[model samples]
Target: MNSQFNFRFSALLILLVATLVTACKKGDNVVPSPDLGAQVAGTYTYSELKTGGKTYPASDTNLKGTIKLTRQTATTVAIQLAIVHKATNETFADDAAEDVEVVESGIGNIELHYNGDTIAKIKGTKISIEGEDDAGTLFTLFATK
Candidate 1:
């Protein structure tokens, strides 16, 4: 009878311990959004296109090359631009480096600024830079990861 009673108490204790352990299990916790600078840091395929408030394929000589962007701070980045005219190999922005600011808040649109001017807008995996050259030739750069 004593052996039988001991077995019953031990079984109850085991069941209670199992219940307590299961009750202490953790639940899923949500993760926060990633930083804008961290997400945009990488290499990209840079395409130079004619600009009429939109992108259009132009000659390969319209400054065709890759653009490399490296994050320097939460609101600043170092840019390495290398572009060339395929016909004459006339390079534009060849190794031209600049530090630009990233505006991420207050308007809800992520934009890259150079000299307090909006140089590019970041959307998803794409970045578009629209401006004129030193000769006043309007062009747009579409870069994608």
Candidate 2:
């Protein structure tokens, strides 16, 4: 009976520790994980672009790539989009690039950074690239695990 009680007590102690760790959390300003939402961690498949009705190809010309994101601070981050469309023309894919620079992520949105004329960032899910030939061209991306 004592052994069983001891096991139960030990389990209860572990549970209590976990509960404290979770409930008595530190302040968000203390050790913020802004990077958790800052950069794109893995490979993302582009199945849809939320901007225009333009469709992606089944095999090639489909927008698919890995964007390496790094949070510079709580209000800013840097992302680089790699060009990985095999059947896509050089002008299109070559026009796309993987360059690193800081942009606005202060509003906690999915930031889209790309280059058409010059590089710019659009924060939100709609994939909005401002001031371009293809304004509002949807960028379909997913975080690849």
Best by TM-score: 1
Please, what is the TM-score per model?
Answer: 0.61, 0.36
lDDT of 1 by residue, 42-142 (tens): 77677547566655553443456776778887667777766677667787655544678777744456787888788777777777776677988887777
lDDT of 2 at 10: 100
Candidate 1 Cα outliers beyond 4 Å, as residue runs: 1-33, 52-54, 58-62, 95-98, 105-109
Which ten residues in a row are the worst by lDDT in model 2?
Answer: 124-133
| Model 2 lDDT, residue 142, Cα | 33
Pick by lDDT: which candidate is best? 1
Total backbone collisions for each predicted model: 0, 1
Task: Score candidate 1 by lDDT.
Answer: 0.70
The 10-residue segment of model 1 with minimum total lDDT is: 26-35
lDDT (0 to 1) per candidate: 0.70, 0.45
